[model samples]
Target: MKLCFQNDNICVYSLKDWVKLRKEYRIIGEYLGSSQATPTLPIKLLPEEAIFLINKNVAKLIQYPKLLVEPTDDCFKEYNKLQVDLQQAEQKIYKEYRKKELKPYIDKIVIAKQRKLNDSVSTSSVLNEELNRMKVTQENIIWPTLTEPLDCVKGESIEVPKSILMKRTTPTKILVFTDLWEKGYYVTCGKKFGGDFLVYAGDPIAFHAIHIIRCIEDPLKPLHTSELVAFGRLGTSVKKKSVLATKTNETVNYITINWLDL
Candidate 1:
């Protein structure tokens, strides 16, 4: 037997004995008093309401009188189950609304930023040199090399010298491509599987270089106005900066990558 809070306001009983009340009474309002009665306030009961309340309360007490005496493990378990069920229902409702209402706005902002990047004139160095003070040797940089090269539709690859590779022990490569920027797409690296390498062509090199320098300058505060503007230029809006800022407290160690390795 269980007590259920139904439709946010009414309480329902699920015992064989309690089920007889439904057959004995017609409308809950006739037995319980005004089906529209608010749950928080006191109810003005007629004779029928008083009789129904006394009978139900007495029956519940008789059946589960121990529950009225003290809190029990079974009672706690039931309470926890109800709480979990309520939370699950709420999360489902929120997720549905977020996908339908919020996602389209985010996509629109991203598209607008991409258009801005496409329209702007290219700059050799968008990031200031002072910001690039942190340097790592090729030997120090980490390179996740590719097992097989992806078929390149455009641009030619140049040989990366071993001398450049030996300069830093851990080399991290940022891949940039002109076509992605020209088409108004934000370039993101693929997942770091074993033996994956970075590659970039034309303007993407400049963007990737700026991103690396930014990562070095204040790795924690990676999303500065300049970075936001860069993203905006590429077609993404900056609304999520505040949310990201909250997460920036988590520590991230620097990993260096040489341009040649990509």
Candidate 2:
């Protein structure tokens, strides 16, 4: 990612490295500020004066980072403070401008302003109603679901509740198979397929059964295997022309087990 600073100089760094540096340096202003150049100061100002000027400009640059991207706590806090300052400054500027440029023009125009103030409403009841409305709004807000669908497939056996699976309108079953003869079976399977089948398939029989079922059913369905496990199914103990095994250091190499060994 290219990080451009206030001086208009850009530095290229990996996203991870940039995040680390941003946290370490607390350079939220540099990241969020507008690309447009600011009015140049004619002479070198005192340190305090320079800081004040920079702070004002810094407020203008304050923006929240992408929600998907994680920023440090300090960066978030600084960004929030700068945002608040920017809003206040904007309001103040607008108020001054309106007073100077708009108030006189409005004053010259004849206007009949009728303010209809409600007298029947009690202040305490209004406050309570507003508070209740705010509470209801907060309660109704749906927070984002944190869990990723792919996360259910990546590493370790995931024991999904039968009840939950049954509740789905179209429940999908993922079956993973591995050859015991293959070296790094669990790692390879998990890396490729991910999920419960990789971890739970302890013996050749279980693995063969799962694979046989998958080979028969997978082609009939819309479901597809991950890129890592696209080599189709494998069998156990069966030695057919389709099956081949090479041994190196007592570990099995790319062995193609027959699909019919179900």
Judging by lDDT against the true structure, name the best candidate. 1
* Model 1 C-alpha lDDT per residue in residues 29-118, reported as the tens digit of each score: 212222223222111222222233343453211122232256678767985676566555655555555445544455454455558777
Error of model 1, residue 5, in angstroms = 16
RMSD of each: 35.1, 23.4
Q: Where's the lowest-lDDT run of ten residues in candidate 1?
A: 238-247
TM-score of each: 0.23, 0.20
Question: For candidate 2, what's the RMSD?
Answer: 23.4
Error of 2 at 199 (Å): 60
Error of 1 at 72 (Å): 2.2
